[model samples]
Target: TYIRHDSKDQFTGLLDKNGVEIYEGDIVKDADSGSYGAVVWSNDKHWGYLFDTRPDYGWSHPVKGFQRNYLEVTGNIHETLLEADNAKT
Candidate 1:
C-alpha cells in the first residue's frame, strides 16, 4: 500500500529575505518585527508572504519585497509541534 499524505507541497522557486529556502510548508518569522506566518501561493495574489497570525486582522500586512531579505526562518509548522512538546516538559 502506498502511503499517501497531504499533497500541499509545492515549490515557488523563491527564497526568503534571509536567503532561507522558502518552501510551501515553511513558517516564516520576522524576529525584529515580531511577525510570522506560513508560506503559500495563489494564482492571483500569491499569499504575499507572512500569512499573519491573526484572523480578520485589520492591520495585518504582507512582508514588503525589500523586507524579504531581512526575514529569518524560526521554524516550520512540523518543527513548531516539536517545540511545543519540548516546552511542556
Candidate 2:
C-alpha cells in the first residue's frame, strides 16, 4: 500500500486515556459529552503539535496539557462521520 508523504508521517506524540496512539485523521470523543473531533496538527502555536478536537465546544487544544483521561478514540474521521450520517437516515 502506498502512503501519503505528508507530514502526518511524523509522530503525534500523544495517546488516548486508554493508551491508544493518537494520529492525524483519527476521530476522538470526549468521554463526558461524547463530543467528537478529528485529530489534527495546528500551526496556530507556531511549531505546532497534535491537539484534541471538540467542535461542539470550540477548536482543538493540546492533548499534552488537557485532561487526556477524558478523551477516547472512537474511530477515524471518514468512517465515524459516515456512520453518524448513515444513522441519521
Candidate 3:
C-alpha cells in the first residue's frame, strides 16, 4: 500500500489491497513491513496497524492509515507462532 500527503501535509488514502483502514480523518505517513505496522495522521489524531499478532491486538491492531497488501503493508506475525510450534515439537 502506497501513501501520499496532500498539500496541507495531511495524509490521504491512496490505495488498499489488504482490505484494512488505517486512518480516520487523514493519513500522513506509514512505515514499511519491517517496521511492523504503518502510521497515519488525521487532523491531529494518529493511529496504526500491527504488522503481526501482538498482545496489544488479538492478531492485528487498529490504526489511522489506510492498510495495503501489495505495496507496503505489514505481513502477519508468524515468528512467534512458529516458535511455539517448534517448541511443541
lDDT of 3 by residue, 7-84 (tens): 443333544444443332322224443444434332334444434434565233444233444334332223334557
Off by over 4 Å in 3: 1-34, 38-47, 50-62, 65-71, 78-80
Better of 1 and 3 by TM-score: 1
lDDT of 2: 0.61
Each model's Cα RMSD: 6.5, 6.4, 11.9
The predicted structure with the larger lDDT, 2 or 3, is 2
| Candidate 1 worst ten-residue window by lDDT | 1-10
C-alpha lDDT values of all predictions: 0.58, 0.61, 0.39
All candidates' TM-scores?
A: 0.54, 0.57, 0.23
Q: What does candidate 2's lDDT look like per residue over 1-89, in tens digits?
A: 11222454444667678887666777677787767766676656421223344445556655653666887766665566677999999
Model 2 RMSD in Å is 6.4
Error of 2 at 30 (Å): 0.9
Q: Best candidate per lDDT, number?
A: 2
**Cα misplacement distance, residue 36 of candidate 2 (Å):** 0.7
Candidate 3 structure, TM-score to reference: 0.23
Clashing pairs in 2: none
Candidate 2 vs candidate 3: the TM-score winner is 2
**Candidate 1 TM-score to native:** 0.54
